[model samples]
Target: MERKLVLQRVVIVISIISLLFGSSPVFAELNTDQLRATFEDNSILFSNNSEDTNCSPNAAQRAGDAAGELVGEDNLKKAFNYFISKGAPKFVAAAIVGNLYQESKGNPILRQNKGSEPNPLKAGGKYHPWNPSKPAGMGDAWGIAQWDPGVAVLYWQQQAGVQGDVTSLEVQLAIVWWQLQNLAPTSRKNVLAEMTASGNVNEATSIMVKKFFGAGIPRTDIRAAYANKAMSWEPDPSIAAAAASGAATNCSDDSGGGGGTISEGGLNEEQAKKFMMNYGENKNNESQKAMGGYLWNNCNGGGSNCVSFSVFFLNKFTSTKGVYTPGNGEAVVSYLRSNRRVPTGKTPKVGAIFSWNGGRYGHTGVVLGIHGDTVIVGQASCSGPGKGRGDGTQSGGGSGFIRVGKINETKAWLGRLPDEFAYPEVDMSAVANYVGASTGGGGGNVAL
Candidate 1:
């Protein structure tokens, strides 16, 4: 009799759960929104007017054109890379993300609601899509930028070419780009430069909040917090791109890092992370400070030099500190050729040291791993893009070590195609996931 009673109670509990969370009488389909809110953070962009937004495609759109929807940190990296590809400085990219995070926490497919918390990251009570005929009042806002009155969608719709997939980030961002460059009001045009050119990330965030997003209720502090976090994620300075190209103000393909796993050159992702925890980020600890001093004495840029950090990482990870290496990044390839007899080549391999020896110091970095066309590189330089031709280091307080991030594989990267990649002097020939060279040059060359 007791078991029977327990079964009845369990059935009742499940019925109640169904009423609240399941697709029962109360909600015809809550699961779809739930999946979208939780897993659909990247309904994403990349439409060639997808039959969508009418803005002329720029590098930002073209670079990310092949990417698909992703959530969390993945989305963050995509956004950062997208802006950097467009030649926006780190600050400009951060400002854009700051504004987006404020609006949708970086969710590309966000809709508005009339609830107390109108912009919740989850769909929840805020799943109201835009409807022009029945505006649905304040709850009818749409897009990552959240154009208001819900009726704003109508204006975008009327534009000749922007007709499909209203929720695509490609569509929305393209439209925003089009409006700013083409249709921005006089006030926006006046302040856009102030927002883009500000050296300080905070100042840029403030101007963006006031002039660009044009928020009815000001939240610069919160937006700036997100912006600052984005800034910290960068591997070099925004100005680093300027050094790479004749132009010193736009975006450049930066060598960046994030966490990755590989079993090559007697190194793994966790060990790479250990290197970062010990040497990278804004830890500002005594060890980091001391290492910075040591780097300054050796690499000549006070701990922020790429050669300094890459050499240090290779030696440490290979468990051979104070070992074979050159003074500047420019000599890394030759050093490998002469000393190690390992020829550097075009293809990137996990656990290889990549050198872009064209500029002054000729930037050098560790290839933590590779995913698709993106290469995760670790180097100490600026906090944005590496100055390809004139590649050098930034002074105090700028990000010097990037043990985890990613960069696109292009000749434009590191000023040109990597002169060559040097494998660490550890046994990786028979490792489970060991990667070999892809080039035709035969004999002793393990990986190029």
Candidate 2:
């Protein structure tokens, strides 16, 4: 009888502790288990006060419940808005939230707590420093996605100082978007396409879990259920569409009245900069390396060839038909002058191709940005680290790879796409803001 009384007291003390610190993993795990059970039974985890049991909860209602239990609703809303504002479909945003829910219970600062062992599987070690020069190893995972050391290092390197604190929801969300944009463009694009086509929350969540998170967790059913739960909370698609429309209008207004509208294929300075930066950053990417190699090998037929690389970016990003020629620098200038030229004396616009005299072929590169006298250009066949052929051979000058640099050594001729051409159907403002913030300034030269 005495031992039985002691056990009851101990149980009461433990229950009190659990209530006091609801964020404890012990409590979190317990709550998840109960939630899982509720899901399995097809019972509602939450309910309206009304008698309509059959009426499913909408996104706002579900979001409120999640806020009470996990991260605040405001943070989740910020993430959703960011994704939507950047052109992601609502379903895809919801899928990301679902993955975050499983990875860290929506806790941005949550770290892996496996144990006090040195091994990542065992947990409890110093978090890896955010450095990309070193290989990422199994270190204590941190932040919203529980990003392993390796992935975290790469992300940190890319964003550099913009990601002030890894634990902050703002930075974490930004990093997530950046990764989708740069590191996994193909997967991200495919997922967005699928979500747009199907508009199915379940399917989007499942695919995101498999591709985005690599099916990291074993509790696939629970994750899917959570994704469904998040779906009910997503902002209306019509609302986001309206916002995007308004943004486009604002962009047109801001670009002055006569330079042509974004919808009409006119490339603005910001849009052009964003495109050039992405190209420079991802030039050596697996998807782009072959094209880079082909352009290097075949575009000039082993002669001094830099014009093809510039033309490649122009054709890829703009609504213009890039000149296809194995021409010298003067030839490229002549081609631009004769075909849709923006005139020679006007200030060089962002996204304009700048041709400079070099040896026999001269040099050509895409004008990324022009800050006063400093003209930043993204060029191929330049000399620098990671800037040449995919096979480590130099093609034109320097390292012979795609790279960005500030040019002061050579006089340049400028050419722009026609003002009547429509810009790419993307939110250029968002891209501009993201790139500017990530790189620490608007005109600073970045490698990629």
Which candidate number maximizes TM-score?
2
Per-residue lDDT of 1-448 in model 2, one digit per residue for the tens? Answer: 0112331221000110101112222212123334323222321112111212222122222111211111235666656665555445556667667777777776666657752222112222222232233223445775666666422422232221121333456656655654443233123322332332234566666766665566545466777787667666656444454334321111121122212112111122343444444444344362144235555455333212456555565455444453456365445544665564533322333445556554555566655444323444445442233332233122323222333223343432223221221122222344344345211111221211
lDDT for 406 in candidate 1 is 38
Model 1 CA deviation exceeding 4 Å by range: 1-74, 114-139, 157-164, 184-187, 190-192, 235-448
Top candidate (lDDT): 1
Evaluated against the true structure, the overall lDDT of model 2 is 0.40
Q: lDDT tens string, model 1, 267-345?
A: 2334333333345442345323433455544433344566666665555444324543465776775676577554344
lDDT scores in order: 0.43, 0.40
Poorly placed runs, candidate 2 (over 4 Å): 1-74, 114-136, 150-161, 184-199, 234-338, 341-448
The true-structure Cα RMSD of candidate 2 reads: 20.0
